[model samples]
Target: MRIMMLKGFLVAALLLGTSLSHAKPLVLSSLKPLTLIAQEIAGTAADVDTLLPESASHHDYPLKVSDYSRLQKADLFVWIGPELESFLQKPVANLPATKILTAYDLPGLFWPDEASVSDDHHHAKDPHLWLDARNAVTVARAITEKLIKLDAPNTDLYRKNLQVFASKMHELDNRLLAQMKPASGVGFAVYHEGFAHFVSHYGLRQLDYITFTPEQKPGAKHMQQLRERLSKDGSCLFLEPYNNLQATRDLAQELHLRIGTLDALGTQSTKTYSQLLEQMATDFLTCLTNVRH
Candidate 1:
């Protein structure tokens, strides 16, 4: 009877251990940039996942029932705040306060040049804060702080990973600043206003843009006005990989100006968050300089 009891106890203990090991850490992100930064701080110890796909426009991203389900499972949720992804507002508010972190709340980041027009939930602030390497540093630190608090047992590991992430981010910021020094205020325009964060950090100027949101394409009248603006000062149109390529191309052709594609949201191969910033800086600088000459 003693042997049989011991065997039963051992079996139960083994099963419980397996169950605990299989339980995953809950992490949810609303954007690709946050997803990448969370993964770095999470350090293989958490299940970091993103809600947005590569091609979805944040301006009109449709929220689904599954998104709410995903949020329910998250121990912590990271989002760009209501300015960028207000679609998540209702659901996120329904979540317990302890479970969500908004990157917009972070300090030491610069707002868009036109504050009155920024954060309007319409044609307003550029939601692409990750494009600014310095902002990414703030985001990574926030992620690390949250992860350490939630997963104290692994605090040391999170700290170490965050340090590595921040170092790489700083390096990228320096690179971007150096590369854009010559192009500052050269005045390029974009099909959309997403480049505000990028240009704001580098001290570059955007002569004009269609709008902050990609939901509404400019009408013919607005297009003519933009053309007139560009005609007076030969400026290149910055395009995004996921935007209406043909329209932008046509605009470029019509005005006889150069056009370049920017990957505001990094790719699967972007791998790390820092690489995304480097890519944007390099691409923008190259595009602007080529057009100038």
Candidate 2:
């Protein structure tokens, strides 16, 4: 009877240990684009989620009481660093270095031109690094490295997922280049300079940007530059998700431009990063072709 009871206790302990070992680690990202990248790496081995709502601006996102609890509980938190999500800096500063991964610290990330980077370190560091395909692969690898440290048991799974993500991004890079070729001649205007990486990457023609960042109003000088350019041709005016609707519509009307929405945040329901990139290219082509001179 003693031996049987001891055996039962050992069996129960073993099953509990197994359950603990199989529990998925939660990977929380600051933005949806980063979440998509992380989900690609985490695969089914981990649960990936985003902190910011799809409609919220990264510039000034308010943290709730529950958000702090989530941050405390998350096994790993990923963010693009102070340049983009400045609000998260203080909340995550006290977290153990191991629990947080900043995409800006990741290798091989592309940055904007020196002018675009601006003197204000807090405001401009080309936070839209994910707009480049190459940076996405780098981010995936860094995420995989962090996950391996957190959950070594899933090393092979994370590595395999990273490989798949890299291959898919490579294919996407080529595909976007080809797809954007026809729209190369379509002169366009963006609300801000955030899309520079993507535009330059795929060789898209952007006549000008109204501002350096979304929150700022378009400077008179920049507006003059755009007026000189867009006045000659009817082209697409690509606006970001955060741009004011009435103001943008009025501007588009003033410039005789066709409006197209570019969800740079990837806020729309896209199951995969590939879909996100494809959607961006499609939106560009659709708007550009429709607004030809």
Candidate 3:
């Protein structure tokens, strides 16, 4: 009887300990690539949540009433800056600063603009910095730090995961550099000015962009200018998957140029973030070379 009781107690204790260690702290309100990187670092340890769904646009996102209540429950909340997801600013400010972090600090892309007419896209200095793999590494490291600090028990796992992720990003940078270096001085124009880091890292010229930013379409004069510029430069018109296509197609047809749609957001189901980086580098090489001069 004594042996059986001891065995039963041991089994019960083991189950209780397992359940306690695996219990997850709620992380709430993720946006865009920052969420993806956070999920990668957190793995299955915590319940990672996103207020905005994958398909939803981060810019001009409205907060749900339920989200306000949910924010009260979060152990940690991650978001891009005011440029991207400003809706969360007021609520997040109420929380301790340690619980809130901005992924935009992870090295943003630079856009050169002498153009006039400040539109929605040019409003916040390009918040799509997380699309770049190099920037993604910075994001991942920041997230890992938070996760480790919040849950020290998983420190080893987070560090290991971050190291692996960083290594992959470094390898991707090298691979892209090799592929893009040969095509030096190549010029191309995106529908928006989101790819500053991408173009700069690849040494491509992006003198004119059609859309002021991803969320807003260009005006008539801007379209005409872009069309004329495309015809003269022999560079391809790169459209983003999430962008409004009517203006882009109109300009492409008018200029008799082919359109290349790059997946800036890296679709939720199709390509993993790392694979998308490789695909983008390949697309740039292919598109720049194939365009008719």
Q: Model 3 misses residue 163 by how many Å?
A: 1.2
Against the true structure, what is each candidate's TM-score?
A: 0.86, 0.86, 0.79
Taking all chains together, the TM-score of candidate 2 against the true structure is 0.86
Off by over 4 Å in 3: 1-22, 106-125, 291-293
Best by lDDT: 2
Model 3, span 208-269: residue lDDT tens? 77766566767887877666667787466787767758867876777766567776556665
Local distance difference test scores for all models: 0.77, 0.81, 0.70
Residues 92-194 of candidate 1: C-alpha lDDT, one tens digit per residue? 9999988888988788876666642222345555667777777877888888888877778888998999889788877777877887887775556786777
TM-score of 1: 0.86
RMSD of each: 3.6, 3.9, 5.3
Clashing residue pairs for model 1: none
lDDT of 1 at 211: 54
